[model samples]
Target: MIGNDVIDLALARKESNWKRKGYLDKIFTADEQAMIVRAENPTLMVWSLWSRKEAVYKIHNRTAHFRGFIPLKIACQADGKVLCGGQFYFTDTIVTAESIATVAVLEERQLSQICYLQDREEVVKKEGFPYRKTNSKPVSISHHGRFEQIVTLTD
Candidate 1:
């Protein structure tokens, strides 16, 4: 399975105060919190990790048949590997001045097959999940503030 998430930095900064007391604790593990603290850009790190978790959560829900956002329950390593129910999902993340985007796959090798598309219209809904219309490849679309990402797999 494939999944993705995106975060717009400007809007995030305007909307959330990540430094607020207990916010990091509520969403991150102790180790994750440490990473954020040590990061040169703590704000970027927080959202990067969050986007990774959100991307992995999409795949987790498909296999586990569960719903809801349980951030701490899903653990993410600094290397973009996410642990959910003992299963490992690998993620590829992009960080820019304005946004952060992440794409996840069940197998690490699948990461190489991921393709980011500029055409949003290629996406269609199947059982409420996104997919590419031409080849029916699973598509993950995420929009936040001014940024959006459309991801799919090839073969």
Candidate 2:
């Protein structure tokens, strides 16, 4: 039972001005802002934090009454791999297991003169009681624009 998520830093740089600022104030808190970013155009930093947040949040939905983005953290190094509070690292990679396994990919990239997203999700449920629901639903959302971002997800 593992999950990962990603977002385009370039797309966010070119596309969003309002959602960047709006979510900054609305979704992120003061400590979260201070912890991840110390820049003026904090949108990209915000998204970086967000991509990690969503990645982990997908695995464990928002159950912590956290006032800010809590499950996501990034190292202040060159490779900003998403961290899940522990030694967990999240990046573009693939892992395999013998039991049940699942994977999710969400990304936005700029190719040539166009920007697009490649989103996919896969679930493998092991042999268990079918009544309890052990498989995750694959979520894919694609958009075409200079920046294609998942604006919102209601539950």
Candidate 3:
């Protein structure tokens, strides 16, 4: 399975205050928080890790068929990987000035393709995996603000 997430940096900057007391503790593990604190750009690092965790969570939810919002329970590494509920995931992150996107696939699965779309309206209109012709794999898609990202997994 594959999962993906995207965050608009401008929107996040205007809306989120990561410096708020207890915020990091609520969503990040001690090791993750340490990485954020030591990062040259803490905001980007925080969102990068957050996107990874969220992507992994989506895959977990799809496979386990349950929903939960315990962010602190998801452990993320600076190198863009995640562990949650004893399952490890391979995560890849892309950070640009305007957005951050992350994709996660089960560690045991092989990722076949990745698709990124900037046109939110078009993505919303299409509304499903649009790259199946090129790669017949289960895909997960996510969008936030101006960014959209997809991750595909193959047998």
Give the TM-scores of the predictions, in the order they appear.
0.95, 0.38, 0.82
Off by over 4 Å in 2: 18-21, 36-44, 62-155
The Cα error of candidate 1 at residue 23, in Å, is 0.3
Question: Taking the tens digit of each residue's C-alpha lDDT, what string does model 1 give over 62-120?
Answer: 76889987999989998889998789899999999999999999999998999888977
Full-model lDDT for every candidate? 0.90, 0.37, 0.77
- By lDDT, the best candidate is 1
Q: Which residue pairs collide, candidate 2?
A: none
The model with the greatest TM-score is 1
RMSD of each: 1.1, 12.2, 3.7
Q: Per-residue lDDT for 1-83 in model 2, tens only?
A: 23344444455456666354555565555666675567554554555455545544553332222344443242322243443
Q: Report the number of clashing residue pairs per model.
A: 0, 0, 0
Error of 1 at 154 (Å): 0.3
TM-score of 1: 0.95
Q: Give the per-residue Cα lDDT of candidate 3 at 16.
A: 92
What ranges in model 1 sit over 4 Å off?
Answer: none
Better of 1 and 3 by TM-score: 1
